[model samples]
Target: MTTFSNYIPQSNPPLPPWETLPTMYDLPSDNPEEPGLPDDFHFLQPLLLYLTFQPINWNPELVYSAADLNLYYDIQHPLWYKRPDWFGVVGVGKLYKGQDLRLSYVTWQEPANPFVVIELLSPGTEDEDLGTRTESAADKPPRKWEVYERILRIPYYIVFSRYTNELLAFQLVGGHYEPMNLTHGCLLMPEINLSLGLWQGSFRDIERLWLRWFTLEGELIPAPTEEAAAATQRAIIAEQEAIEAKQEAIEAKQEAIEAKQEAIEAKRKTEQLAERLRQLGVNPDDLDEFL
Candidate 1:
């Protein structure tokens, strides 16, 4: 009698799951299950994060950040995902595999997970964003906090409320997230050489207290627009300085010419006086000795 058994096939040299598993294109990037459009703050805050998410220790080409992008964490459940307001990853290509733009951030296919994630608080998602909400069913998806802390194990998690202008931060330690104390109004992450804090400034022409990235020393990271503006201002100042330097040089030259003219005029007057003295039988060279 022949026994029937299941046979598993394997690849020689063992191809990684990324090559065999569903890629970003196979995953659904849209949030059709959820309803409602993001408010203006949602759009603006994330934009600011995306613009200034330059990790000082990481290469610019290797740093990638997204806002409102689906982050697929579970390989078993490829469909499950969380859309972070803003998330940043280091040691990963800015583009997908250095070739194409990513439709979604698939953790299994990517080299590294998000190092930091920011959630902008709203009335609807405040509980979930702050880890106050718990999943009612086992089959249901985990909360945002669970995914960030337990599953993906993101190093830094930040939440900000525009309404209250409050900033909260958490650091993953010993497989769990602990509340991080703000050091001088900012959460310092020395690994990435950056800080997360609230800035009372204008972004996108809207003036308010906004969540922003900062240097480890608590200096604000300039956005692209701000950097451009700073460059222009520097150029203008340089031009003004050059103009002032040229004017000073011209004034010095004029003074030198005037001094030379005065010396020549005095020499001519002395020569005339000497000639007149000679004509009167007096020596002009002896005048200084007499004086």
Candidate 2:
């Protein structure tokens, strides 16, 4: 056997050139110019991310092409120009090359386009969201509905109003989007095996309209915060059940003691009666014989 110190160590190799190594830049915000997408936008991001892990081709923030410069569409836009609030593509890698960060997603550059698009209606963009034309035609883009239905040709489009707590979904047909009823406030996206709907509950100490993802069967997908609350609720229920069971056992024991006391009292009364009859010279045995 060779001794532990007998083996020789090899020299370490030199570091590779920085140019050969891949460089990744931070993701760009679509509404960087504006005061950012709004507080509700943050709330909507996670639900969009959760939808990607499903069986459908779900890319969270896929970059798609518009013109030339890689425009990373929030989810993935077909062109470099416009970006939907939340979008999904059915057949794209979650990440390119497991590390090839995308500068932008150009549909022409990518193999697929978004199957669905969601717009979070805010006070600033409410008009555009409702398909109303902008009065000034100088530098504004076309209405959102026209772009989503005609240009992008996204199969499904959803508009959620935080103020009204309402959701509207449209499906593409004959090169146009037709409004579809979301019965009981549930919109089912069959492509992704999920549904998009509004859940009226409190989150982060804020009680307001929350956009949430759901299963096809209308079960609200629990956020991390919601899951914790549910667990706590279950624990409380179990504790209550244990307390009730203990109380019931104590009540049963008390009832048994009371029953035994009653039996003793009744037997004592019968003995006293027999003794009184014996003192009165009327034998209790003679009375029993007559009866």
Each model's lDDT: 0.88, 0.65
Enumerate residue pairs that collide in model 1: none
Off by over 4 Å in 2: 1-82, 89-113, 122-153, 161-166, 191-193, 215-219, 275-282, 289-291
Model 1: residues with Cα > 4 Å off, grouped in runs: 1-36
List the candidates' TM-scores in order. Answer: 0.84, 0.59
lDDT of 2 at 29: 40
Per-residue accuracy of model 1 over 1-291 as CA lDDT, tens digit each: 533565556567977899999985465425655422366777988899888888898889999999889999998889999999889999999899789999999999999999999988765577788998756468888989999999999999998887788888899999999999989988999999998888988888899888889999988899989999999999999999999999999999999999999999999998898999999998878788989
Shift in Å, residue 204, candidate 1: 2.1
lDDT of 2: 0.65
Best by lDDT: 1
Candidate 2: tens digits of C-alpha lDDT, residues 47-101:
5334322432345344321211232333333333554566666666656544775
